[model samples]
Target: MGENLSRRSFLKGAAAGTMSVAALGALAACSPSGAASEAAAPAAAAAGEGLAETGSYDVMSQMSLLNRNMTEGAVAAATPEEFIVQKGDGALQFAPGGDPLGITPADFMQNVPAWLGEAPEITDIAGTESCDILVIGAGNAGSVAALRAQEMGKSVILAESQTYDEYDEYACDMACYNSKIFLDKGTPEVDPIDVMNEYVRKALGHVNLQIVRDYAFRSGEMLDWMMADHIPAEYTEKYAKTSNYKGNENFSGQCAGQWSWPAMTQWRDEETNINMWPFVIRSLHTSLENLGGKVAWGYQALRLIQGDDGAVTGAIFQDIDGNYQQIDAKAVIVCAGGYGGNPDMRLDLSDSMRNLAWAYGADRTDPEMIGGMGRDGSGIRMIMWAGGTMEAGPRAGMSIGKNGAPGFAFGGAWPCFGPEGKRIYNESMYKFGSNGHLDLMPDDSLLVNVTDANWETYLSYQGYGHETMDRSSDYMVEEVRQNMADYQTGPDGFPVRSFARFGKEYSNVWAADTLEELADIVGYTGEAKENFLAEVAHYNELCEAGRDTDWGCDPQCLFPIKDAPFFASFGATGGQPSNGLVMLSGVNTDGQYRCTDGAKAAIPGLYAAGNTCGNRYGIQYGTPTAGNSCGFALTTGYCAAEAAVNDLA
Candidate 1:
């Protein structure tokens, strides 16, 4: 039953049912007189030729029949006894009815597949190749480093994770810097001193002074480098035009009357003209190639190679096809971006910054959003593995978005929502005047209403105010009443009504009606809500008087809430999660950006730049000081290259 069938036997069996004339003739062709000679001459060859000529059996048909037989044999060979089952009590039992092997489920399982096979066994002790400088990560920083180093007559090599086309395009493709918005406007400002100070104060709680001073002082020079390199002035101007300068001025007092200077007027246009990321990368790549520098893509650096004394020497990388290569260099520059992609890394760094969400204006619904595939925190992990310490900074990450919401907006600012759609916060609260900006002081305020019933009703309202209105009176009254009824009686007992859900479940609730009632509903037991209501009434009175006394909330901007069903939503303190906008306090370095370990001076070959190198800004987020990130990236790249060349010489 298990015999391997031969092709001739199979053919004989097949032909038994369908005897052909050619086969009969082939048999008859042999004569008795020359039987020995004829039989040995070629009857089999003639029969084969006849079969071929007649096309009796095609190759496909033969293969199909063979496969069928194989499949049938495989199925017949399988038995239920071959399977091993595990009992509920965790004992391994033999499969029922006759398999003698008595194999258990435990014996059947294997370890998870190793995506990368066992580490390469190194047989040859080949010496390392020498290079003047090595640039890690072929993104903006590394590319610029290699280009500049080569220009200075140093041999440089660039290693990137993916091919150039598939490299970190997300950071480069989008206009990342805040300057892009300013460049869209006609005028941009350059107050490096104040801008730097403001940045540190707002971002870092004004703690690190020296760091902010250095960044502010160097930022202007960084911009100048970009211009000298033939990055279009128009691009800078466009960014200035669309820049959020006014908003920054309103939020921070340090920028009062500080307008875009002529040199800083680079961001006053509306087109994607001077974005230095793409321009710099392409140009630097070409320059490095021309200068005899080699670029290797699709390679990932797994670990840093160190010396006996613990001085960094080089690195080991795994190439695209699983080949390992050790790159020897006098210096290595780590330019990989921050940990925005890795949620675990984010949690490790700061628990509050754990939400995985897109930045504002990012299209989460779009399949092609940058950084969508999430390989973000490799750089941080790699450095940690290399024995580097992370600096103390703001724990910053994006907020949790309303589940199933169309898009995500930053926290801190209150979003407007009405019965129908989404809305913006109070516009007047964002205005900046000549002397100072109008800051909304809502930390201790509360919404007050008239009756307990009305208060309960207001707390459960689904509708929000209009974008411009900031307070939707009608929607507030109706929704609050509905909510109160539902809370007192069960949903089944409450009157039936229909309203489109606004935002996520968390944001669906609203509060307002008469001021006192609104206060009770918001759970303000003390005079806190009452006092705030009194202040509101007084403010309304000031509006009637056409002037404000306690605080200068313009009467024109003030709207009276004396009407029936008056309500107020409690305002809270704080802004969106920090994104490390302004750089401040980083590893100390010379003009070459080489980091010192604080025990001695900096290591001869090492260089640092961008946010990693630090000492740029202090602590402010979203300063109208646009183009700072790019400037730092370019300046550090150039400085690192110069240092490398000098060291080689």
Candidate 2:
């Protein structure tokens, strides 16, 4: 067998799991629900009239769509599957062991070059501090490390760019099946071995099996500890039966394994119904403080300080007062989020998708920077300056929508009409696996979502863009909850329920009474426009036929554009798609969270956790699951702290 094929031998019995890039892209927007329709055609398709039928599906009832599409409809096939090129030869390389999928071990673990040419230099320091371990970014991953170090009685210091006292370090989503919640129930039916098996398959064997094993065995214990020691009891019950990926339960024999904090729940009023995450995080923060943990709220790690021999001793940090602070440490954990919020840094992953969720023109409902925090690119870049390699991933959890508040309704059947005026992907697969963003490239990303006026009026724009705003009187917020309730009530309910924030105020929406006019408004020109009209006509014919002969789209989403005043909405992607808006490319790490500086060696005393580190994904984001971003944060944070503590012991 080949070297890579040989490595798979050891992964056979391993039980491990964490993070799905796609799950993160869909869940990060603070919205929820999923569905895939495979049924009798909608009334509109059968009647050949726009007067009847609302095109959408019931996630609970129509699970076949989820099972069939989520499993089959990837951007490209894996293993022995034949490669079907989506674009020209210049399109993304989709070979099973290629850049957009998997790379050779040598290439993936290469050393970072000293000649990046643009990295900042570190020299003098205003003041120096020492610790047994120093951890950066007090978000999900960092918090775990700091607390775990305390458990081991190691002197630790944790730093954050934004002070939690002023701005909450929001963390709620946690996916692990080993906790008391699962173990206590005999028939919990979640197999860690099975989870790990699924995990490696999803990661395309590009991950370190050791890391998966470490997290797999420790997650339940860690979560149990958090529940018993850090968080209150009542909040634990609030966790719904969901996995990191929203629709994971639809998969056969896949236990409902995902959990969330209250505040992070979608469309709910943050002020009225408080999220338990803030409390859990704060409690951990307090535990760190009580253990005499040193936390620098406004201290930002600027560069990783390395010895001439390549041992990382510390980092150069920018203090709140604008002075440089030096941290002398035996070990360090970098946990700042990935470059999701940094548009410029995002070019590494998406040249066209340069903006993040909060960046102007991005069509997301949540106010977070692309992945989490601002896409500052600091943590990943700092390690790059120390010669750390980055994992090139096509999946950044970027499941974006054109209009209709893309976050809440990741499932509906709205046609994504490309420049060719053709259906680029199954509407459900828009963000699932279709790297349509890259294949479409410059102009194809500018595709539009054709919807009716009713979708825009009721389903879009649910609450304030920022969390600080009062949601008490926000009718949109209330309306969304009711809509969601109605949908969950079964056949008598609305076809869809959402808390989206799609409206004229978002600015990407356009309405035209005629298809020709609609095409003109969105910049469909020349043959593209001709293609657009032909597409609409052919699509109308298919609607009448009640089947998508061209793309296998669900009839539920096949409601014709025949309705006058038809609506189309666009966003910061300019209607383009992406692996995810978050800048997913970043520093490579061993499964142990040790930052690797090429094949020469893993830089000792230097580790990366959370989005700052890569390798949890081979190329695409977590496919079968979604919140791998957050899951990685928790898993690596706990594991990194354990490694550092063991060394000191």
Candidate 3:
């Protein structure tokens, strides 16, 4: 009856077309006879009676709008006790569901998701192979592990699900502080301690401090070593000498309250200006083959073969021809990337990201089209089935704001307004931090940014690692203009940018001579339009005053909207938000890269690196430098190989 009442209230709220805090509080009180339910009864009754009286109740709807609908104090005042889930760690507010989708954490951990059904019986093995170290997933980490292990004189087998051509392009940048290349170019030395400390703070102390410290100190040497024999020294030297952030007068290591140093080296080939990551990876594969290592292409790993002692001994694979093959190994390193392609895993783990996922139509299961391309959680699931543990709930992910457009880049301190036509966030926030706020907004809500003619000058104020405006202003503007000029007019006569890669079109960018016309194009109507103009006026006042009195945005980032040709950029306009390149969190692992148990004890014979390794990022993917994801992949993959080899010895 209690559950039925909850369902009835949910239906009522849905039918009423308003999921207000009061409605939500009523739904929460559906559970019977508890102090929490007792405390929530009045709010529930008022909301229920209001709905019953008018067939709709929305006076307190603004209370649920996490964007700019209500002040912080008002939100705090309206927050009900039932919404705050008290945990051992701390009080978690607005946790309508204690677990992801209301599924208990214990249930999530114990039951295998339907997508990852029971493992297939290994009754028929058409072929058999053996190796000292079997590396799964020929991505950034897997390839590195295979190469490092082969270089250590261990027989290695690197298996990949995709064809050689399919696994070509990858991370375009590499992070390595104090490398030989940086030293040679006379670049200022960055304190790795400061960087790691920032990482810990961003991750909320959920990261393995030892692993972070190791990466800070040894990653530079690993970078030097990885490229020593693979990429041409000339290309490395050229990019190291070049590639510094340009056009920013107030160039500093800080932007939007985030600390970011110019530590990542963009891997671009000097001859063709193409990404050098694939070239280096191809070179490594060639060298591995030359050194008697096997590269098994198109062989998808199905499951692990554990011995009586519960140690993973080998793995089962389904080849391209659908024939089952067995590869026995003393040790295995799972680096099949994270579970970004697995919607079930993402939905199960990322409680905080659910709204963001829904808002952007990004809750997808397609391996190629999903935010984390080609990551199907095969590696992580295999490890989990073999007794490995995942990092705690509220998993970290890389959400770098809107992608595939020439709008504001991630970490850009540009003024953005929410659906309510009110300013959203301290515009001077790192992309991830700002996107975290974006996640709190109602699903399908469009976040729009309005900027005037002097937008280029304001854009230069941003200095975060990912969107550091590395090129000249002329170059940046020219590139954007070229793309914008290519916009096609649909039947409705609205200009839309056609993203050929995804077969989708979006009319997110617009220009108008007046704020009113711009507001109409961006779908601001009635009260929203009035609020939009008022916000612009207030913002202009702040700009003229040379200070942001409201959100405390950096002075340089504040610009008046008086100039004509006002431009606007809208996110979630195409019904999908930007989910950066990949998800960052993964299986719980120790400093040695061995997958750990609940007690942090290493699970022998199994190792994880790259995105498959967890406890690297805290509850969110925050970084003091760009390319640390790829950097950690390279560093941990190499070191995991070293650890496996040494342990075997």
lDDT: which candidate is best? 3
Candidate 3 residue runs with Cα over 4 Å from true position: 1-119, 182-186, 233-247, 267-276, 353-373, 400-406, 409-411, 433-436, 439-446, 472-533, 544-546, 562-565, 571-581
Best by TM-score: 3
Task: Give the residue spans of candidate 1 off by over 4 A.
Answer: 1-129, 172-189, 204-214, 230-280, 351-375, 398-592, 596-604, 614-622, 626-632, 639-649
Residue 177 error, candidate 1, Å:
12
- The true-versus-predicted C-alpha distance at residue 350 of model 1, in Å, is 2.1
What digit string (tens of lDDT, one per residue) describes model 3 on residues 107-192?
33445666666777878899999999999988888888999999999999999988776767567666777776666656677788
TM-score to native of every candidate shown: 0.47, 0.57, 0.71
What lDDT score goes with residue 588 in model 2? 78
lDDT of 1 by residue, 1-649 (tens): 1245333343454456554666445434431222222222222322233133554422222211222233343433244444322122233222111111222223322222122113334434233465768787766556767877777777888888887777544332211222333334433544566555545645545333443454555544534554446355554443432222233222222212222222122221112233344433455576678779988788776766667765667667777877777788877776655555543344444322322223334343332232212335444444444444444544432222211111111111121221111121232232111001111222232222122222322222211111011121233335434553443221122222222112212122323445555555545556565555665566557657865454454333334445554433333222323223222233445445665544436654566655455444432223233344445555566566666677667
lDDT scores in order? 0.42, 0.56, 0.68
What TM-score does prediction 1 earn?
Answer: 0.47
The C-alpha stretches of model 2 lying farther than 4 A from their native spots are 1-124, 170-172, 181-188, 212-218, 234-280, 342-344, 348-373, 392-424, 427-581
Worst 10 residues of 1 by lDDT: 461-470
Compare candidates 1 and 3 on TM-score and give the better one: 3
Rank by TM-score, descending? 3, 2, 1
